[model samples]
Target: MQKQRKLVILGDSAFAEVAYECFTHDSDYEVVGFSVESAHLKRDELFGLPVVPFEDLEKHFQPGEVDFYAALVYSQLNRLRTRLYQEAKSRGYRAASYVSTRAFVWHNVQLGEHCFIFEDNTVQPFVRIGDNVVLWSGNHIGHHSTVEDHCFVASHAVISGFCTVGRSSFLGVNVALANNISIGADNWIGPGLTISADTEPGQLFKGESPAASKVSTKRFFRLKED
Candidate 1:
């Protein structure tokens, strides 16, 4: 068997832990340590590995010897992750992308740097996903779809074929985009929304949350239980 590639993960947040678990189990990279900013450094160790400061990561782990993965969430509409990804690039460190082995990504699909595609994501043919994009589990990215940079697509979102999701867009859970639709930049698409037409830039579409029923569940069911 081939030797595993050593990796240094940036950040120690929940997303960092999740990224570590996935990379450890499903990918070709071995996570050696984690790195964070000095001000945000709370602990010295995570997952039984040393947590190095991002400012001095090269001192502990050489960039030439190890690859780096920025494990950050969609804070600031994914701008945080995108910023760190750029910092890594400026430091001459190559960004690592995670595409789960269980995801059905087409052979012709093109994915950019620092992308995180979780399990059960079905990416159809001719899909082009840009840098620092996060695709949570169970999403369907249909054929010829283009998801631009710094976008965060939540679980169960369905981006139909020939759709174009612009940069920095946040697609909530269960959101559905119809075929040939164009979602503009920095749009916030709320949960359970169906976008059949093109959206303007910086639009915020919020779906109404389900209201609670006046009657209790026990009274509504009316089933006798001894």
Candidate 2:
């Protein structure tokens, strides 16, 4: 086996833990430590590794020696992740991308820095994924689609062929983008919404919740209890 690359994950949250598990088990990355901002540092240790302040992380782990992965959620339409990724790049630290071994990514697919593609994701040929993008489990990225920088696509989201998801966009679970559609920057797409046309920038879209029927299943089936 090849030697594993030394890595530092910049977060101490659930996302960071997930990153550690994926990188450790499936990839050639060895997680050395976790980090957060000094003000947000809750504990000194995580997963038996030292949790350091991100501000001075370079002092402890040299940029040339260790790579960095910004493990963050889409708290601010993925803008926070983008900012942190840029910060790591400015510090001369190499950003790492985690593509799960279970994911089916085409050879022609292009992925950028700090991307996290989870298991069961099917990325088709000619797909272009930009920096700091997160494709959660079971997502289907169609052929020739472009997901721009800092976008977060949740589980089971289906992006059709030739679609363009703009920068810092957040796609909720089961969200479906139709063919040739364009999702604009900073757009927040709620779960189960289908986008068939181009969306304006910084839009908030929400799907209606399902209402319960008045008729019960037992009544509808006309089944008698023994």
Candidate 3:
């Protein structure tokens, strides 16, 4: 059997724990430890492994001895993850990407470093997913689509063929983009929205909740009222 590569995860949030589980069980990487900023280092251990400070990470585990995965979410519009990913690279630690074994990625997809592609994702051919990107479970990246750097696409998103999602964008769950759509940088597209046209940079698309019906459930369903 091939030797497993050692890895260090940066962050202690729920996402980090999920990453640990995925990498430990699904991938060929062995998670040695976790790290966070000194200020946010609440615990000294996680999953029975050492949780060290990011500032002194090199001292604990040399960069050359292990790779890194910035297990962060779309905080700060993904800028935080991007910054830490770049910083880890600058510190001479190679960034690692995780693609779930259950995902279906086409042969020609171009996936970059520090990416986390969850289960049931369908990545079609000629797709380009940039660095520091996160594709949550059950997403569909249609053919010839490009999801730029530092973007976070939540579960069940549908980016149709020839679409382009710009850098640092946050696409919420169930967001669907029509074919040839161009989503601009720093955009925040909320859940259940369907975008058919191009959007400007930093645009925020929020879906409105449906209004409550004037008729009560008892009236609608003919149920007995108390």
Candidate 4:
């Protein structure tokens, strides 16, 4: 049997815990510890492992011995995760990526480091997923699509064929993109919105919430008075 690679996750939030569960059970990596910035180090232990300070991480574990995964969500439009990923690389630590066992990625897919692709994701042929990306459950990346670096795509998003999602974008759940659509950098596409045309950089798209009916539920349904 092959030995599992040692890994350290950088963060202690919900996403970090989820990453721990996925990497521990599904991947060929063993999570040994976690690290956070010194100012934000709220706890000393997590999941029975030590949580060390990022400033002093090298004193605890050598970069050559352990790989790192920045398990952060799309905070600051993914700039936080991108910064830490680049920092870890600058410190000579290899960034780790996780593709769930149940995901169907084509043989020719080009996936970059520090990415976390959850279960039920269908990545078709000729797809290119760049670094520090998070594709949540049940997303569809059609053939010839490109999701650029530092992007976070929530569950059930559909990127059709020949689409290009630009860097640092946050795609909300159930968002769908038409074929050949090109989304510019730093976009925030809200849930259930469909993008048919190309988008400009730093655009924000959200659907307006529907207003409630004026009539009461009892009157509308013809219920008897109490």
Candidate 5:
């Protein structure tokens, strides 16, 4: 810890706002404001913190003077936060990471720089996590489980408490992995998939959906142009 630094959260969602609360409660960084790309500005305030445009935020808080956290949850375009990570680095603001004091990180576990691991994560013994990783709430990472660089693990995903998560992979919410399974690099595991074997590199596995039943127009509401 060099100086008590200023901070700017890069999103306005609950996760970002809550992280602000978490950081302030445990650290000395004062959160200056929230920021986002111009197109998706929500309200002007987040948890009583002022909101600002991402491009112009540097004017108010110099990049070197303050640090930033992406704090954006993964959704349709999971790569969005990755892009923001690069953007922040290019602009000279060091990215900050927050590992919750409540997490069960074992002695042999390793976490890289800029990893924001939140509450209730059970990172077991010998588990290794790479740089730029984000582990959301209440996940179970089993012993000897290794998550590579730049991966995102959604809330409640069960990484069997030996499993190896590959680099740049995205594990959807509630994903279940069997013990000793190794997922390859650049793969995407969709929500609720039960993976029991090693997957090839660049593979994607999604849970099967049940067949949809045909319905008449009366089953759904329709709005007509006025």
Candidate 6:
């Protein structure tokens, strides 16, 4: 087992905050700071810890001594967490992962660097998860599913057997991936989607729209204006 020391949060999201709490409670990690990308960042503090810029996090916490976990949550937008995780790793920052005590992971399951498997996730046998993944709460990873590098699988997603989720893919909440499927790289799967076939690289998949409510446009406008 690696000796846990001072840890750093790599983003300013609620996920980062949750990781801070989880690590402090369950592990030997002492969270030293937070980090943000050069662009699209605000402020300089998270819960009183200095918000170190992703580019210059090392100035605040050295890589050799301090471990860092990217705390970005995946969304409809493409691969932000994946991009930042790779950048941090390239900068020589050690990526961290959390397998919650409530989670059930098989002893032989292989989880690579920089992954966070949250509460109640059931990781079946022979699963291979690559670097920088977030398996949020209540996910079911069926046997032999390979989750590639930089993928973010949000809460309550179901990845069935023999599936291959490619690099930088984002699976939104309640998504159900069919067995023996291959999700290509950079794909953004919207929430409530069900995929049954191989997705092409960079594909954005969405669910079928529900039939419009019987309410007329006038009713819709009135509801919006209210």
Candidate 6 local lDDT, 34-107, one digit each (tens): 88877957988888889877877778888788888878776433256767777877888777777888899999
Give lDDT per model, in order.
0.85, 0.86, 0.88, 0.89, 0.78, 0.80
TM-score of each: 0.89, 0.90, 0.91, 0.91, 0.81, 0.83
Q: What is model 4's C-alpha RMSD?
A: 10.3
Error of 6 at 202 (Å): 1.9
Which regions of candidate 3 are displaced past 4 Å?
Answer: 1-3, 209-226
Q: What is the TM-score of candidate 5? A: 0.81
Residue 216 in candidate 2, Cα distance off native in Å: 40
lDDT string, candidate 5, 52-89, tens digits: 88888777778788899888765432456777877988
Report how far off residue 65 is in candidate 1 (Å).
1.1
RMSD of each: 10.4, 10.8, 10.1, 10.3, 7.6, 7.6
Model 6 misses residue 16 by how many Å?
A: 1.6
Model 5 residue pairs with clashes:
142-161
For candidate 4, the 10 contiguous residues with the lowest summed lDDT are 209-218
lDDT tens digits, residues 44-149, model 3?
9999999999999998889788999999988767777888899989999999999999999998999988899999999999999998899999999999999999
Worst 10 residues of 6 by lDDT: 217-226
Using lDDT as the measure, name the better of candidate 3 and candidate 4.
4
Off by over 4 Å in 5: 1-3, 208-226
Q: Estimate the lDDT of model 4.
A: 0.89
Candidate 6: segments with Cα more than 4 A from true spot = 1-3, 38-41, 75-78, 209-226
